[model samples]
Target: MTASSIEIRRLTAADAAVYRDIRLEALRLSPEAFGSAFETESVQPVGWFAQRLDGGAAILGAFRGGELVGIVGLMVADGPKRQHKGTLVGMYVRQAARRVGAGRRLVDAALDLAAQSVELVQLIVVDGNDPALRLYQSAGFVEYGLERHALKIDGRYYDDILMAKDLVGRA
Candidate 1:
């Protein structure tokens, strides 16, 4: 599918079921890429997922041919000292949607929302995920640090690369 065919929108509680399905798929297929585990999130009720959409964090979804195919989230800090910062989290694009612009559009939408309330946006990608790393970098995110053993699954450890983009002068 072409990039022009992908539709990006902020998800609501009404879209929780599709969101949950896509989220579980991501965790199951790419276990090392996320901090959350499929086994942990799989048992949660749909209401639990709905609550996440209803929560303050901005969760954006990508639609292709009227189906939810990808999702990304942005969460701004609520504390007094950290309120200027936000974290980009739970980025995933279905295998079928790979190589299209859905992932990039989702990131763009999340960053656009983050720019509204936070001066900087941060994200962590698994060390070996070159596509995701390149996507973030191409979008103006710069590496700040690396966290060793950021995720441990099935007796294996994975490192994470920390990246951030300053929104101070972004239009």
Candidate 2:
């Protein structure tokens, strides 16, 4: 399918099944890109995924022809001190959907939601992931730091590039 044919929308509890499928696929295909392990999430019940939909987070999915093909998650911080902060996570686009603008649409949706309430949106991308870094950069996210050993999988460590974008202004 073409990029413009894909539709992006917020996910609800009813979407647990499809969400789980794409999520597991992401974790399996790119283990270094996320903090969650496929082995841990692969066994979770659909109810567990459903429950996640009710939190202080927004999960956006890209669908083409009614089939979910991509997803990105945004989480707003709780507590008075952290209320203006939001975090981006779980960004993934299916191999077939790459270079089709699904990732950009997903990020734009997340940013739109975040702009309503948060002052800043932050995300961690694995080092050397040029495509994702480029996406975030094009979306106005600037790298502010890097965390060494941000994730350890199968006895190997992967560093994470910390990037953030100010919603009120591009600072």
Candidate 3:
């Protein structure tokens, strides 16, 4: 599929069912990539997922031929001292959707939304995910630090790479 065929937009509460499905898929398929586990989220009610979209966080989804194929979220910090910052989280593209520009579109849409309210956007990617590393880097995110053993799943330790992008001058 071409990049032009993918449509990116903010998710709403009504889209919760598909969001929950894809979210569980992401957590299940790449457990080490996220801090949340499939076992924990799989049991949550659909209302919980709907609240996630209705909450302050801005979650964007990529639709290919009207099917939700990818998602990314931008959460602006609410604290007094950190309101100028936002976090890019829950980024995932389905196996069938990878390499077709869904990932990049999701990131771009999230960053665009973030740039509106925050000067900086940060994210943590599990180390060794080269495609993710490249995607974030291509979007101007720079690595600031490494969190060793950031995720310990199934007795296996996985490091995380912390990245951030400054949105000082972007339009």
lDDT of 1 by residue, 46-102 (tens): 999999999988899999989999999999998999999999999999988989888
Q: Name the runs in model 2 displaced over 4 angstroms.
A: none
Q: After superposition, how far is residue 96 of candidate 1 from its true place, in Å?
A: 1.3
lDDT of 3 by residue, 1-171 (tens): 988999999999999999999999999999999999999999999999999999998899999999999999999999889999999999999998999899999998888888788999999999999999999999999999999999999899999999999999997
Compared with the true structure, the alpha-carbon lDDT of candidate 3 equals 0.95
Compared with the true structure, the alpha-carbon lDDT of candidate 1 equals 0.94
What TM-score goes with each of the models? Answer: 0.98, 0.96, 0.98
Report the Cα lDDT for residue 148, model 3.
100
Q: What is the C-alpha RMSD of each candidate to the true structure, in Å?
A: 0.8, 1.5, 0.7
Estimate, for each residue in 50-103, the C-alpha lDDT of model 2 and write its tens digit. Answer: 998766688999998999999999998989999999999999999988898989
**TM-score of model 3 (CA atoms):** 0.98
Candidates sorted by TM-score, best first: 3, 1, 2
